[model samples]
Target chain A: MESTRPKWPWIVASALILVWTIFPILWIVMLSFKRPGEVGNQKGFLPKHWTWDNYRTVFRTDLFTAALVNSIGISMIATFAGVVFATLVAYAIARLEFPGKKLILSFALAIAMFPVVSLVGPLFDLWRDLGLYDTWPGLIIPYISFALPLAIWTLSAFFREIPWEMEQAAQVDGATSWQAFRKVIVPLAAPGVFTAAILTFFFCWNDFVFGISLTSSDRARPVPAALAFFTGASQFEQPTTAICAAAVVVTVPVVVIVLAFQRRIVAGLTSGAVKG
Target chain B: MAAITMKNIVKRYGDGFPAVNDVSLDVRDGEFMILVGPSGCGKSTLLRMIVGLEDITSGEMLIGERIVNRIAPRERNLSMVFQNYALYPHLTVYENIAFPLRLAKRPDEEVRRRVTETAGLLELTEHLDRKPSNLSGGQRQRVAMGRAIVRQADAFLFDEPLSNLDAKLRGQMRTEISRLQRRLGVTTVYVTHDQTEAMTLGDRVAVLRKGVLQQVGSPRELYEQPVNLFVAGFIGSPSMNFLPASVDGTSLSTPLGRFEMPGEQAAAAVGDRGVVLVGVRPEHFEDASLVSEDKRARGSIVQVPVDVTEWLGNELYAYVPYEAPADLAAQLRELSRELDSDQLRTQAVVSLDASSLIAEGTEAALWIDTSRIHLFDPATGENLTRDEDHAARLTRAAEPSRAAQRSTQQPTEP
Candidate 1:
């Protein structure tokens, strides 16, 4: 049945979707290479005079550099913390039976589904009162909390796929419980851990609502939120070209991350852990 | 290396259901003991409890002379091969075999030496650097065995280790495991529902039904003088045929026909009960015409209509259908269900020589060895004619050969 279908239509559809998605990213790249003065001229898709001035300007600004550091530091911390906590929680949820386990899972799903926008106003007020406003901790706390539910869900699914016999065989082979978990369970779950970490990192990196509403300075402002505050060389000028450059720079890590760990994320690492 | 002794061991789950109920077993040093039953019979649970993976609700478990009921699995110093051959996927075969030694903080020199030796033993040397995911099912199974054997733990426990393999591979691995166990001379407790594994691999076998221990004896003893109906029905392929019979002096009337037996044989079989179950193994019945004249005179012959016949090159099996009493039919149905067989109708499977000319839907005369048949009390399922002395003699006769085999192989091991 599948072979009988003409191949051209499917190929055309896929090519159309590919261009639709890549066109915006291509436009951003083109805009980033344009001169700041030419951004508003509405020239052709290619920059009339391609220049490195915008990229140079993006790096020269203290606000952009500091925000870059803040973004990297905050996302890494949140992803590390979220993945560690989720791994333990997911292992318990997958491998153990306890009262309220279903309740906890449902609660996690609820939090994951809760609107981030609704929590912003309340969290902003809470952070100010708690002296956490305009700080890395302020942004990190919310990022980890938001990232945890999804991380736990992904990790637990991976954990459940792992056969319990692997750990039992380890224990019977003269490993303590901790050793069995570290040597057998953890290695089997490495792909899951990497996947959850990348997902959490992406969440923290691309966040704008909390980054914009809760932070007020370069001290904790991430790249997405910091881009909004960029000013040109003069009062009447817009930093459109510089902002595009910063956007392109920010997207590099996300792309590199997905490319580097894509195989690990997609591979089923538990394949030979037990018999089919 | 160690004898594992369980005394009145009981395991009760949270719902207060006993999974292993008051079972006492002794696996002597250098003995291969098999725990076998149909699914949900707690054979695997019993193996888990011995390894300290499951907590015992009551009674004592001893490894060697140490009471290991409170000890964790690792500290108990026993290695187990799981039914699934749980090899660590991320580790190379060499690293997997070296896992236990590494856990014990053994020197790298010794770890390398031991792993190499074990890998050689299981024929896994060429796959040393390859991860489990790259190996075949049989290779992965060998790696799992290598990991277990490299530890040189007190004893080895196998939980249906060959069940995951294909039939031909299972047969080959069965012999491999048997040879390995004999070479090591370790106290091994193996749990499997396959009766062939139980009979072929173990020096003695324990049969369990509904978490209750039925009988523990040498395989020959269990095969020849089963204590009850369940063991008789469970321990063989093409299981024993149960015929509802009523005792009347020296003759017993069965659904097949009335059979007159010698007075001594009848006296041993006839208890206070008037109705009993007569267990006749399929091989005990032969084609009457094919039997030797002297053997034919020693046993009785029964004429019955053959319902079906299967000829498998080497031997022929003839099925004789009969009308059983309603109450006994229900009893047999329940027994068959427990034994993992679905026998919706009452029939006798009679094994005959391949040369026999028996055909389906025809009348045939089958000679039954009357002296070898067992009589069971219908109500309690206990064997009325179980000869305890004879069973003991069978077990006693098996010991010297086992000790001789062990001694001959002792010098080969370090």
Candidate 2:
């Protein structure tokens, strides 16, 4: 709407932001394709000698493959669990009337704001004592707990945006309570659910503190934690390029998810939902 | 279709404040009943209770002979149109209208046929495949109407359905709804806060104020013989003007002038020589030059300078501001507040004929019809010149045709 302003400022600002965000990922991808000797001996930002040796080495490791499977399986389970529970809680918070409703919202906010590192020490001690250490449930349980507040807050805002009269009209049109929920409300909330699932998956996928603190082996270690334990093809070889290859592989899912749901995520975050 | 009857219905919230207080009314079979009032008057609360969406704290609700207090909304066999249209955003017009039939597990063929047929009735055949989001406001409203009518439920409840539309579209939809109701002969209970909608759409309109039923009568009855000051000010377009008056024998003293009160109207006044409100509709006043000499002699004429005049094509409105006693001004202020209208001052509007040429700043002779004047008690806000029981009787008289039809096995007569 401010058409009088020069257009160059926005183009320059956009280029600066793109460089700022993409520089690190580009460096990692460049390193992933570099020879082991050339990684620490970089002549410039771009790799002088490129090879598939690092990617071959990363894919050939049992530990890396095992951790990749663990990360995918655990993050998916946690995302599903968190989103399902969040939907119920969000629906209650958004639609139903009860005492202490504000208290519930405040509680969710407090948990979301709570520092994850502060809970790591206690969680580590508890997991070990309960024999859940080095297990998939150990990581998944914390992932769900941490992801719930985000999912709940986002999903609840989305639920509140829906017109309540549509639900009542469904009932008056001869749908029972459950039918009304399934037939009318659920389809309307599908976009919000997708948005919540993506966010929860991203949270669980990118977690490092819980994965490292709770699991000592690849049995439950996610890719972020597993990347630290990567060894080269031999004891004398540096594993920097192999680790970079693994990091690049792990970032693929996040990129794919972001690209697939960029528009929906923007809508979910910005949808005030009060308009007709 | 069924007649809806409420017996001493009360809707009290959790805090024990009654939103709808001990209200009782019967909506006859196939009759268009309008529940109208200002916001927070409990008209919507009453409509919600009938549809089983809100709990009736203590009351008996009857759909024909069956009590529906314990029934759920779906089981109560009624349909409702919301002010927002409430159409499912995900469904096409065909699917939206077919939803109830599909819910009841009707045959797929039957659902398709009925949906197409209903869409045709609402003139939505061309947009049957379109979602609610793709349609315009008026089209979406019609789709909502199609959804309500597809199943032929026991009754249709409309909660200010036309309020979301523009004035022109609202006028169009109003006549469409009236035509649909007449063609279908479906029982309906509509709730709206607009007095114009209430006056035009209802076969019988019930006016409410502060959770109590103020008056229930035909539009003509409520307009011509209001039960109280609130109804008088609430019904008409340029609402009836209330001026402080004092009664002494047959003649009433008002800020405008002294006019002879008819014998029947004077007898309706309660105490002698007490302050009363004299209400005269705007249409009852005209330019003295426009009236016959014989008719002009039958009423009082007041010469007042017109502050402003509006020529509205069909009629002309002139505003005549006067000075009233402080107590009377305060009384009119309180009366306007109770009516949910703007604060009233010492103003009288004389709706003269368009040809009268009553220009502003000029003194105009305005003849008032003394017989049509309504007298009211300032303290109680009751109409002293209209019988409340007569208005009630007029409303109740609408129920016998339905009752007679229910009692006989013969087919209903037109």
Candidate 3:
């Protein structure tokens, strides 16, 4: 354990990554509280005059507010549906004895491993054919389809580490497999399931290309597409602080959830490799 | 709470190779039976079958006269304690113990009462609110046991529940689980590879090897009169010493010396003198006068040159190279067992008081009582007098009385 200073190379590497990755986030946060005059052109490491106006201005925009509610609403719904469907599929694929179980799991993994860029055109065509384009369900259905596969793949790995004996113990104690899964396995796998939810939430929430391509109306558009609509042609007349403030809302929730679950998330991600 | 019987039980894995083959046993109401074997011998597989966690590939399993081959594990109402204790890490000790009762839809008051009572019994009352990860291995084992007894399950199945503990704690928990099993008396079936656990805790131990039942008997029965070569070698610590010997006329001769066989094997000898396996327990040797020319004496002794000694405080086990005949290695190998040192050098051990210790690399004959020598068939690996088939047939035809097994067909009182 003391010799875990084998961590030196990784510590240095992670420090470099932390500086690069967190720099923009820190910059955005710093800009969000800056006065309008410092919106884009302002220099200096710290804000000269910090105020709540950027936040207030972003909140006052109907476009930003609608999209905020839409993003939260869609992401939360997608997360819920993804967890339920994915957890069932994961437990089945991991624990149940069935024919072609491996193939079904491989298919889910293949979907995850497959590039999303390849599906954008095909999925867009299908959505247009189904007349779901420019709608909330339009956004939800495809996001769920994509999110479920990854969620199931990850959650199943978590479920596999749990001994089948615990379920057998529960079953012998009078729990049906479903009841055992819900009452016993789910609580045990909450940290893992939380990780899957967080990832799925961001998969849809931070999506700009798909969200913008899928919806064109305020009624069904999410915050990402709504924020994208503020740009004219190739650029926008909107103040940089307003965009920075929107970026804060878009990125902060995921960042905070990930930070809170950092330990669990690390364990969950590597859990697929081998048990520690 | 219930009697469990397995009639010709067989379990084959998905690949169709048998994990447990044609095993038959019975557990009387409230009896504690242990299924023991080396790893991959399928003792745990057998236990899982009894709990309905694994399907019986062949034969019938009855719990209280109900054939439960197709029944679910939960429906069998047997609680299992896993090797890792399998305690729910997210739940408190109290909750883990009460999990079964809660599943039964018992009132919170009832659940709380049972949990508290069980925790108090295990002396885990103070840890009731702590999670399994916070508890020590022994405490977690107690919690697993408490969960088993807290519910009125028809039976208890333990899959090496004490294996993960340290050696000292393993012994400690062995005593505790034994006491708890006796007190609860819920028809427990424990699986373990540790022979000491098999010997110390079980009412009757079922020994398995390569998916075959070797023997099932009390600890003393397995030690004093194992049915076959496998059981004899496996059941004892510092396992039995096997040396190649032949029946030369009325005497059993090896490089050590020719000694008289007990009367039972004497008749079986019948002048056939190829070679045979001679088993001598370490403790069977005594310090006799180096010269005992009267080989005709019914009770005989042998000389052993001391080699290396292991001092375990209370008793010392001395390994001796008795320099037996050249064929001893062949006999052990033929029997699918090995003790290579007995080749150009044969080995014997003497369990004695630590004070009377002999220094290593010395020539001294520790007399072996010839009457206690067990002669075995080399090719068949069976005790010559009793053999595998005869001991098993006798055990099968055995009545419930201890006398049935005491000196079975042997002309002796003890």
Candidate 4:
């Protein structure tokens, strides 16, 4: 069902995606299992012994403990809240006839288009002035702000494919509009929801640039901040093994989530895509 | 079971053009009604309106006598089967059928019984554990039907349910759906562009064109007495033959053949604007030899060149050359390619009664059942057979008056 193109340009492009996208992730994963002393000393494709001592050290640190909890809690909360809110807006935007929809969608696209990192200084200042700095709510608020637009766009495209008749059928079956949304549209929109959740989690989890700038305390830092803690240039050499161990801890849970849901996520993402 | 009513329903998209105009029809309780038209003719939109899928821009919708214009589809107590089936691709057939019930918190045992019964009816019992993607096209369609049937709604709305199937499968599913509807006896509204489905499945077919309702009647009523040219040409397979003709005393002067215009149609053709259109059915044209001996009894006979031929085992249709009058000839020439349509060009279809079939390119005398001829005002496109004097009086303004009118007529055999 697929054609094999022998053109050099496209073959090079495929190799580029494999190298830049896949190889770096695989290398990072391999580096995660290396010993604290041996890590960054030399690069290798595989680890010898693959000792768990670095993992134990990461677990023992207050920053690692707090950061892991904060990252998981904030990502889950944002993903859940973003998905719920986005599904509702998606249904209305796709199916119902309402004015200003075009303007609102354009506003969403603008939100996605605007550089998220540019807002960190203002957000940090705002949160501190509001007496909300170094808090879970402070981190979550920004996380949702960044993740919501994409969630809504993905879910809305999926929602548009659900025939209005299905909702009509639900309404005629003694279900209210809200009931139809909950029962029919929600289930039918699950693939989109899964994709949105995965994307939201990854976006929030992998955000080092904003995480570093927004929080300065152990109480509020996520894993990305904890990983950055070891990067000092003044010779108090950061334990590469402990950092790799933390990275492994942070990346594995999401990798599992994505692997479990790869089929649905891929299908939803590529539904109207052009294949190579 | 409940009868559905539309009181001048209209649907206007935000873009401002009305997708459905003020079209209204009575869908009888326990009857299978069909809304049919060409693409973009608003047939699907009309069905959606009754289901409350699309809001009524103006006018009222009543399910059995209760106005549902403001009611949500779920609250209206109807179930619809979409064209694509809309079966949850992830759920097994049993779960798909059980979905609405489960949402209502029906007991598991009751859900099981209903699902089993529906599965048995649709012949999907063996594949209850299979997901939709795992099922074949016909099986998926049945799963869709099974989902609709399990709900026990007051009416079932089907939106081109069989359009995805190939030709043979479409015919097979068409019969299966019609039978299923009859057995279930729930009021149903089926929409399709295929006239065969409309004529075969509907208790009364409502023909629509560009958002306007042309006519709604029993298949025979629409075929024999269509209200306008659109209905005349749209109601049948291969369609009715239409040619330009003029009123000349008791007869119509047509280039294809002269016709004895019925009195109701004659008066419509009289005086002032005299130009009109003539219509005759393909099957109604018999071999002149097949006609009864009397002149009036045998009716008007015309000569046509059998331009093409098709043989379908037991049934045969002939496409033949038809001459047009000067004005019509000019219109026919511009549209000649259409008149001698690629579908039935080089011929005017004449149905063979499994007898000696007509040969191609041969001249033959064809007789028309004069009683079955239809006329239309070329200017307004209204059917002349609908007595002008009785036009407004023939239709009723209320339920009781219509019911009284129905009670007075002889009951038709099912």
Per TM-score, the best of the predicted structures is: 1
What lDDT tens digits, residue by residue, belong to model 4 across residues B318-363?
7776655566555434333432233322225677555645777788
Q: Which lDDT values do the candidates have, in the order given?
A: 0.90, 0.87, 0.77, 0.77
Among these predictions, the greatest lDDT belongs to 1
lDDT of 2 by residue, B1-414 (tens): 999999999999989888999899999898889999988999999999999999989989999899999999999899999999889888888999998899999999999889988988899999999888889989999998999999979999999999999999999999888778766778999999877789877888999887889888888789988888888998997889888877776777887778778565465555564678889999999899899988887778987889999999999999988777787788788767766776656798779899997889998889998767888888787887786676667656755743453345233565
- Higher-DockQ candidate among 2 and 3? 2
For candidate 4, write residues A1-276 as lDDT tens digits. 366865789889999988899876777667667764556566567887687777777788887898988888878887888778887887789987788999878888899999877888898899899977888788888788778889889988888777665666556556767887877777777778888888998988888876787788887788898787864222464577677777878888888988898898898897622110
Q: Clashes per prediction?
A: 0, 0, 6, 13
Q: What is the model-wide C-alpha lDDT for candidate 2?
A: 0.87
Estimate the TM-score of every prediction.
0.97, 0.94, 0.87, 0.82
The list of candidate 1 runs beyond 4 A from truth reads A1-4, A268-276, B262-265, B411-414
- Model 3 agreement with the true structure over B191-289: per-residue lDDT tens digits: 988879988777788989867888887776677777667777777766777767776666667767777667754556534756777787876765554
Stretches > 4 Å off in candidate 4: A1-56, A231-241, A272-276, B15-18, B257-273, B288-297, B313-316, B322-347, B352-359, B369-371, B385-414
- The superposed Cα distance between candidate 2 and the true structure at residue B245, in angstroms, equals 1.4
lDDT of 4: 0.77
Sliding window of 10 residues with minimal summed lDDT for model 1 chain A: A267-276
Collision pairs in model 1: none
The 10-residue segment of model 2 chain B with minimum total lDDT is B402-411
Query: Which lDDT tens digits does candidate 2 get at residues A1-276?
Result: 669879999999999999999999999999999888887774677888778989999989998999999999999999999999999899999999999999988898899899999999999899899999989999989888889989999889888888889789999999988898889877888788888999999999999999888999878999999999999989888999899999999999999989988988877777834333
TM-score of 4: 0.82
Classify candidate 1 by CAPRI docking class.
Answer: medium
* TM-score of B-chain for each predicted structure, in order: 0.98, 0.93, 0.86, 0.85
